[model samples]
Target chain A: MRIGCGAGFSADRLDPAVDLARDGALDALVFECVGERTLAFGHRDRRADPQAGYNTLLQTRLRAVWPLTAASGCRIVTNMGAANPMAAGRAAIAVARECGLRGQSVAVVLGDDVTSLIDADTPLPLSGCNVGDVGRDMIGANAYIGADAILPALETDAGLVIGGRLADPSMFLALLRHRFGWDAADWPLLGAGTLTGHLMECGAQITGGYFADPGHKDVPDLAFVGYPIAEVRADGTVTITKLPQAGGMVTTATVKEQLLYEVHDPARYLTPDVSADFSGVQLTDHGGDRVGLRGASGTTRPETLKVTVAFDGGLLAEAEVSYAGRGAADRARLAAEIASTRLQRVHGVTEDLRTDLIGVRSLHAHADHGLPVAETDVRLRVAGRFESRERAEAVLWEVESLLCSGPAGGGGFRGRITPSIVTHDAFLPRGDVPTRIEVLTA
Target chain B: MSQTQTLPLRAIAHARAGDKGNTSNISLWVNDPAHFAAVREQVTADAVKRHFGAQVQGTVTRHEVPHLHGLNFVLTAALDGGVNGSLNLDGHGKSWSFILLDMQVKVETGTL
Candidate 1:
């Protein structure tokens, strides 16, 4: 069986997905879109507008790929439903109808949202705080559902399978499991399938998009990098490759980098499906952008399903001003000091305020040990978090004041205030969250 | 002792960083198997923690992937509260890999 990745993230390119659906001879196209913060924002979007919770590009993506998938009989599986799968399913149906595929069916997998199961007394493992003490408006909670939730939808043989918080790897694993008719207790096969899903989940990462370094690791024609495709056998061995005409090269290096991406313990990668062990995984480079992989194993699945609990985290205010020429770094440093003093003394907004000189030492300032070097250009940035808009705007107010009140050569001032959300990890019993599938036809 | 020289990890290895909540994981892979031992010897969890200093809070653990000649360093509380709450421009610490790659390691003069 062959599976292709259409998107690695919510905003991944559409043209590559279009390329895959049309020419890749794919049996299934998976779009894994939801991230921790994306889901939190999804809840906020849904609260504002009932139909706005799904991926903002759902219609555009579906329209571009639906026609091709319809023609090729390649099923589309995705978590583009985000905070609202039912609504996203309806949106997909609309896209199908618009694309002239009137009989296309979309299966929506529900029950990942477990907000009703949580309460004020619920504990958050990472924050060491209970829901009541978080001191912010609770948005919602979503359990990371696995293959079981998605399997039924795929079994329906719907043209589209959609869900919210579907575990990234499980989407691909479900397809492989269904195709191979593998038993749920087959740990080794599940492990291999999960490995395939993880490798393909990031799309172009394994295909050389993020693996490029001009002098060191050169990737050809990265501008038009291709997404990845996985060929899985019944025994769970797989080979990862991409379209021939597409850009980017897939070698052992790219494969190894992606294998451990976002992975903590190589021996214990805990997904809802199984605790996949990638430590012993072997990679063979078969010239022409094809890399063969095997030896991934797994133990039992985690008893509890991980959930992301989100809260309205007030506002994040950021303001910046640039300085250049002979004393650029000095001027930017002075601007930062001035902004810091004003935010603290005048505005009383010192809690989370931070200042940095971009060109000199912004990102690594916390750990910088190198000697200071002269810089011709520098931008001073001041950022803070506030509970109220008034306080948040104070951050911008102080930085903008530096133009006239202090510093020389301060120009190109820009400021923004964004509503933010904070998330923490929680776990729910697998039995507590039962999934149901609903099929809709255009 | 035989003649030895120092080179930045980037000269012999490549890395990619990823984040989960406030923790950041950087996987460093040596271009050649010959350099893997030199890298694994110097790039320990404690050395990495010191290399990062105050930038990372909490403990750092190094997981060895000998078969791939790679070392996975997991730094907890490394992202300054991670993507959601970090005020740093690179909240996800995606560039942290470069920071790790910038570390200088000792190698035999002719190892390259």
Candidate 2:
């Protein structure tokens, strides 16, 4: 069976998956969207509009990939559901109908929401603070579930599976398990399957999306980069490659880079399905864009399910002004110090206030190969977080004041203040977060 | 006759960096299998820590994937409180691998 990745994230390019569906001969196309913070933002959007919680690009992605998938019989699985899978399922049907695919079966995987399961006063594992502390300030609580939550949907002949906070790998793994009838208890096979999913979860990352480095690791024609396809067998071996006419190159280096992406422990990479072990994993070049994966092992699944609690972290505001010509570095630094001092004294905002000269030193806080004696241009930026938008705006206000009150020849000023989502990650026992799946046809 | 040359880690290896919370993991892979030994030896956790200097506050743990010819360095407290909490524009520290790959290393001159 073959599975192809469409969009790695909600904001990823939508055109590549269309190419995958058109030329790659895929049995399924999985789009893994919805990051932890993204769900929080989705929750906030849902509160304002009843039908507005799904990924912003859901319609565009569905329109672009669904018609092709519908024609070719390639099933769709995605976590674009964000805070509301049911609504997203409806949205998927709407997109299908709009795209002239009227008979698409969309499934909504349920039971990931566990807000009611947790006591309001229960302290989150990461923050050690109760949800009640945030009260209405809390945006959303989503439990990270795995493939089992998605399996029933795939089994129901649903052409599309929409999930909220489903573990990214689970979407692809469910397709493999459902197709091959791989028993959930088969730990090694599950591990290999999960490894395959991990390698492809980031879409083109494994296929040279993020691997290109000029002369060091050159990827050809990245503008039209090809999405990855994994050919899987019943016993759990996978040959990962892309379309023959695609742009990117698949090599051992690309596979190795992606294998360790976001991985904390190689021996104990935990997902809801299995504890995937990549320590002993092997990658061999099969030549011609095919890389074979083996040696990945798995133990039992984790006892608990991880949950990310996103709360209103108030607002973060940033303001910047640039300076150039001759004494630019010194002017920018002076402007930053003065702006920060004035903001603290006048606006009484100091704790979270941070000032940095962009061209002089911002990325590396420690690595100052000694301050530039004479920079042609520099941007001085001041940012701060506050409990209220008014207070946050005060920092920006003070920085803007520097336009007239301080600095020499500083121009190109910009300021922004926006609501911030602070995430607190926690885990609950599996028994408490029982997952259920349901199918909806368009 | 073979000789040694000091060059950036990128000369012999390439790396990719990923972050979780405040910890950053950088996987460095050698261009050739023969140089895996040199990467395993010279690219010590201490050396990585020093290379990053004060950027990495917590400890560095190295994992060796010999079959794949790769070295994974887990750097703690490196992301400045990470995505949700960092003030840096690159809160995810996605490009940190390039910095690590730029670390100077002494390798056999003929390896390149």
Q: Identify the candidate with maximal DockQ.
A: 1
lDDT (tens digit, per residue) of candidate 1 on A1-442: 9999999999899999999999999999999999988898899999999988999999999989999998999999999999999999999998888889988899999999999999999888778988898888889999999999999999886999999999999999999988999899888889999999999998999999888888999999999999999999998999999999999989999999999999999999999999999988999999999999999999899999999999998899999999989999888888888888877888777577788888888887766646566687898889988888988898898889888987887999999999899988888899999999999999
> lDDT of each model, Cα atoms only?
0.92, 0.85
Report the error of model 2 at residue A22, Å.
1.8
Clashing pairs in 2: none
Residue-level error in angstroms, candidate 2, position A412 = 1.2
Provide DockQ values for all models, in the order shown. 0.80, 0.64
Relative to the true structure, candidate 1 reaches a TM of: 0.99
In order of the candidates, what TM-score does chain B achieve?
Answer: 0.97, 0.94
After superposition, which runs of candidate 2 have C-alpha atoms over 4 Å from their true positions? A120-123, A126-136, A368-374, B1-3
Best by lDDT: 1
Per-residue accuracy of model 2 over A61-93 as CA lDDT, tens digit each? 888888888889899999999888889888888
Docking level of model 2: medium
